[model samples]
Target: MAAPLFLLAPPRSYTSLVNAMLGQHPQCFGLPELCLFNVDTLVDLWRGSAAEISENGPMARHGLLRAVAEIYCGEQSTATVNMALRWASVREHWTTGQVFQEIVDKIHPLVAVEKSPSYTISVKRMRAMLDTFPDARFLHLVRHPVAQAKSLLAINDGAFTIKVNAFEIGEDYALMEPQIAWHDINLNILDFLDKVPPAQQMRMRGEDIMAQPEQRLAEIARWAGLRDDAEAVDQMMHPERSPFACFGPINALFGNDPNFLAGPTFRPHTPKIPPLSKPVPWRDDGKGLHPEVVQLANEFGYV
Candidate 1:
């Protein structure tokens, strides 16, 4: 079995695009955000986790359902998705690792590439992936804390911060802190990666990938033991070409970010990297990133 390539990053770090792009490689099968490792069994996903904040409802199941439909049934349609539901029902009792192995086996030889940012919230979840796929390759995708925090705040008022328990509790109130989320999530990834061999893991900036997709993507392809030739490089350029790049059927409309689903096309351009000292745009208080956030950002090679 070909060990899967998992992108480890917090949300809004270009994981969806990168995963799809890599999946488009001739030797890869880019998967939607399966989020299977978030739980121990398939039934746990439906029944929900202990933490209400972690419970994802039906939308979370969409990715696995869509993937099952496409991989096993040869298409993702209403009928196929319903068939996926039946498929899951039969395997609800199986360990999530077992189910993931089945999918990896089904797409053998074509490396499975996936990213579910939620997996970074807990070390256990990431360790589950490593335990299941002992030889899994991990890509630690980093982003500027300022840019990532701003993006998180823009979405549902930084809802993910709450999910990660990233907050500052003042005497009067508790405020969401995106930078904390960014720092902690990356730290979690680092801790988990400590057990992985150096050769099995790589760290790359999301901004770098955006700035030089062709060169950087070819580098990544070569690193993953995939084809770095023109044909494969050209294929990797068009993330939209991936089956999971767009919205799935009505029953399973999203296996990736909704924003990405709406416009799955890849347009290469340099992303703006805001100065660390400047006041974050998402904050009303003229405050820059937290000291810890700045420290981590510097460690990541950001100015």
Candidate 2:
């Protein structure tokens, strides 16, 4: 099987674009966020705990279904999507690792490129990924937490972090924390990296990728043991060219973020760096980044 390359990071850290970009390489297959490892069995992706029950409890399954439909059936239609559903049912008892291996094997000779921010939610989940693919390559993607948190709050009332329980309950039962998701998720990546060989992993700043696409992407390709020549670098430059870059068939319109799917263009421009000393948007009162967050931003080369 081609080596499975996983992008490890928290949500809103440019994983979607970067994953798609790397996937566009001729020898790589870019996949949407398949949160398969969150459960033991394929069917567990559809099942939900009583406390978290919702109509979309199995939200992660859509990506797998659409991917299978697109790969096997050549199009992600209602019929093909149903077939994909059946495919999952056949392996309902399979572990996520086994299923992931199956997909990688099916796409033989082409590297599997995937990023599931959900992987950072639990140390166990990250461990599962490492255990499953001991030879897997990892890219620890980082972004300025201030910018990430601002973007997160802008999207859905900061509900994404809330869903992950990346918040603190104060004595008054108030959400009193800031950058909890950013800090903890990054810590997860750092801790997990200790278990993997240094040669098999790379750390990248999202800003660097955005600001210097050709340069940084070529570096990434070289580090991942892929071609870094002109043609390969050219291919990696156009993330929008990836089939999964856009929304899948209407039946499964998205296997990734709707916002990213809507605009998957690659423009080389410097991202606006938010001030670390500024007040955070998620809070009513003015409170800026903690000392540790500043240290992290500096460590991430964000200044």
Please list the C-alpha lDDT of all candidates, in the order they appear: 0.90, 0.84
Give the per-residue lDDT of model 1 (tens digit) for 44-94.
889764244334567788899999999999999999999999999999999
* Residue 14 in candidate 2, Cα distance off native in Å: 0.4
Which RMSD does model 1 reach against the true structure? Answer: 1.6
In model 2, which runs have C-alpha deviations exceeding 4 angstroms?
49-56, 168-173, 176-178
CA shift of 302, model 2, Å: 2.4
CA error at residue 231 for candidate 2, angstroms: 1.3
State the TM-score for model 2.
Answer: 0.93
**What is the number of backbone collisions in each predicted candidate, taken in the order shown?**
0, 0
Deviation of model 1 at 184, angstroms: 0.8
Best model number under lDDT: 1
Q: Residue 241's C-alpha lDDT in candidate 2? A: 85
Candidate 2 versus truth, CA RMSD in Å, comes to 2.2
Any residue pairs clashing in model 1, and if so which?
A: none
